[model samples]
Target chain A: MSKKLVEAMADLEEDAVLAEVKALKAQNVPALDIIAYLQEGMSIVGKRFEEKEYFLSELIMSAEIFNEASQLLGGGMGGAGSSKYGTFVMGTIYDDIHDIGKNIVTTVMSSNGFNVIDLGVDVPTAKYVEAIKQYKPKVIGISCLLTTAFDNIKECIQTLEKEGLRKDIKILIGGGPVDEATCKYVGADHVCKNAQETVEYSKKYMGV
Target chain B: MKTNKELYNERLTRIKKAIALEKPDKTPFAPMMDSFCARHMGYTLAQFCFDVELSNKIMIDSIKDLGEVDAASGTSSFAGGMGLIFMCRVKLPGRELPENALWQLDEQELMKPEDYDTIISKGWQAFSNEYVATRMNVDFELLGKTGAFAPIADQRMREAGYPVYGGGVVSLPVDYLSGGRTMAKFMMDIKRMPEKVTEVMDIIMKNNIETMKAGLKAAVDPIDVFIAMARGCPDFYSTKIWEKFVWRYLKEVTETCIEEGIAADFHIDANWERGLDYFKDFPKGTCVFETDGMTDIYKVKEKLGDIMCIKGDVQAGKLTLGTPEEVYNYSTRLIRDMGPGFILAGGCSIPPNAKVENVRAMVAAAAGK
Candidate 1:
């Protein structure tokens, strides 16, 4: 039954995954055990993505199924426990409200076992400072779709430096317009081309 | 000295020849710029968004300043029409944001799942009218004002010796639904209720094609219709899902454009290399593939150079962050390598903060300086 659940999740068979989750729960499987299976399935999904067999749509569908199946397990994935990897803090920078990229990264990060702190869109620099102080994430991501927000990202990173929070955490940036030039301009440690890159970067940073 | 009328004709000829996959006298520079014009002209983004006449003047003047440009992708823009195009509410600069901030789309789940049935029953036009008025909070007056100014802007560009490329804008139903329902939810709908979504899309496509044909018929000297397809990039979907949801409608729209005797300017954003081969089905010289720098343009040339005219792809990052020499070198390389059927343009639109010298370098490269 567990193998069926994992395979269903990997194949993005939403109904089958839900049915199996319910069956497993009826069989008195622990919520943690069920979440482990889902994660394993997501691992397959991610590997497919890296191999180009899947794409962003598949990642999104797999995440949605995992979330739905987690809901069926009584407590949500949030209640599963702390991630083995450390927390990740992220948001779209100030004056940029685009959230699709940011949301994708956070969702992929959460499914990949990082506790993500999504500060939401149009996030002020102070918010990043606050998130860093509280979450103490090993890596942070700043997303910006607008060229106008580049200066704001620069300012956000400068604020982190001023607040003495810049030394510990690696700052990564990504979005439509961002590139290595943007990474340099914004003083970020790296630029992720997509969500999977974010997961890989954070995982490497966390040494997981 | 040549008159502006003579110059306009020459430029138009150059652009048309490039689209027809013929070698022109020189490569045409047809950069798409909007907010960049506002900043170049020292106007606030708020002013550019709200004042159509000023926006038109800014774009024309900016193009003129970039010497030897053959055409412009678009001449005027209105922030209000953004909501209609994207099917979401827009947060305009100076209204919900700072006086000079760039306008943004405030995407939310404004169109519920049941709205698909509404579209099926009421039709896209009737349903969209009610949805925009009730849910989108679009300023109809502003839309009207911009609508009134677009012709004037096109005329002004012609008078300034530049041919405007895009006749009108059309979008896929998938893009509309994605914007209205938000991407995540819409992607979910494609999984959970694929049939219902396709039904709604078919209804919307019928109306959209009719509207596009009507707009093209009414257009004065229509050339190519801009078909926005960023949201439907194959990078975001599996081969099966993309073929069914995105390519079907996209092909239909492009076929409609071909049937109507107008070029389809595909304003494709994001990376579309995975689906580049799909464009091979189109007849030679009937389409223009305008990519936004994400897709490797060289591969586009390698695959579709004989089939379609290629425009674009000086990246936004390079324009905003790199120096004039880099821009000049890149543009010169493109002109040298990708010409005959090539039109030089910024990847999508020039970023607002792109250096004036860099833009000048791009034009100069095309001018063979």
Candidate 2:
């Protein structure tokens, strides 16, 4: 039944997944087990996305469906107990308001059992520093869609370096305007073109 | 040295052969000239966008310097004057954004879900007029001054033996909603109220056909409309969802273009390796496919080269930051790989900051100079 539920979520059949989760719970499946099933489904979705069988909208849909199922299953599915992979600090940079790319990275990362602290859009350098200090996460993701934010990324890296936080965390940058040249210029540890690459990079840094 | 007319004829023949899926003397080059022209002429991008006379002059000068190319180019970005006259959602230079930043269309939900019924009832024109009146602040008199250079620019290019290709417009149902109500809202609509999405899409399909028809009339003979397939990539949706929402409208639009004797070229972005099958449905020799470097142009050539014209895709990053040697090497590989049926252009809008030397290297390689 749980495996079937995973298939439903992976296939992006929203109602079927919802109905299956409810049915499993009605039969007295533990919330924890249901969460596991949901995670398994999301894993498949991520794999499909990485393999190019799925795209952004499908990924977003799967995330949406997961959130819906999790809400139905209740509290234990997210946050500390659910997170096995360490936390990540993520945000679009100060001047850039685009968040779709950031949101997808956050959602995909969190679904993989990484506790992602999304700082929302237009996040200032100081806010990122504060989050890094608070979360002390192993990975930090900076998303910027505009070319103007190229220098701002450098400033963010400089600020982290000044505060002696640069060496501790792995920073990955992604967006429309970012490429290998800009990635080098911004001084990030890595550059990701998509959410799947971000996950792989995060895992690689953590040696997970 | 050859006369300008001789140069123009040579370039035009190259483009024509590529479009017809035949080998040209060499690969044709049409760099996606954007804000680069403004900067090339020692003017700030702001001066280029706002000053009509100066903008046109800079365009003429840039082409003259680039020497021979297949087509006379224009800035792909919409004129900044539109933003000034109308309360447009587009961010323009010297306005809400820095003078150097490219003009960007804001994807805000200016229309709510409730507006769907209103749009369906009133029709696109009436709805659009009302939407524009309520949504944008319009000053037609000021807007008229924005294009004092357009006619003169066209004439000057022709006199210089450069013929501008007709500007093509494409409209996807979801894109119309994305522009008006923002992508986020429209995406939510697709999930939450799918039936309504389809209903609205049907209306948009008819409206888009009308738009393409009008474009054919407005364009030069042998009209080819460059389909703006922005935000309609395979990455954005599941295959099931894309077939339902996007492909249907796209197919209908292409059919209209073909029936009207207008050829279609698309500006496809994102990694759409699995979605190449969609191109197969278009009749052979009826269309051209252009990619934005996200989808591998090599793979595209391998698959569709015999059937349709293929243009594009040098990486924007390489153009902007790489050395001329690097640009030359990459351009050579693309030419060698794509052979005939290829027009060398940036994968998308050439970034405003691309070095002139890099641009020259691309053109020079294609020209065999």
Best by DockQ: 1
lDDT of 2 at B308: 83
Candidate 1: C-alpha lDDT? 0.88
> What are the Cα lDDT values of the candidates?
0.88, 0.75
Task: Give candidate 1 regions above 4 Å deviation.
Answer: A20-30, A72-80
- Lowest-lDDT window of 10 residues in candidate 1 chain B? B71-80
Task: Compute the lDDT of residue A105 as modeled in candidate 1.
Answer: 88
Q: Give all TM-scores, in the order shown.
A: 0.96, 0.86
Each candidate's fnat: 0.83, 0.33
Q: Write the per-residue lDDT of candidate 2 for residues B87-176, one digit (tens) a residue.
A: 236656687667776665544667888888887788767777777767754434435655554566666666676656555566677667
Instruction: Indicate the worst ten consecutive residues by lDDT in candidate 2 chain B.
Output: B79-88
Compared with the true structure, what per-residue lDDT tens digits does model 1 show for residues B60-165?
A: 8888777698877677867768888889999998789887888889999999999999988889999998898899969788778888887888888888888778
The per-prediction i-RMS, to one decimal, reads: 1.3, 2.8
Off by over 4 Å in 2: A1-55, A62-82, A94-97, A121-123, A146-149, B1-6, B75-88, B136-149, B221-223
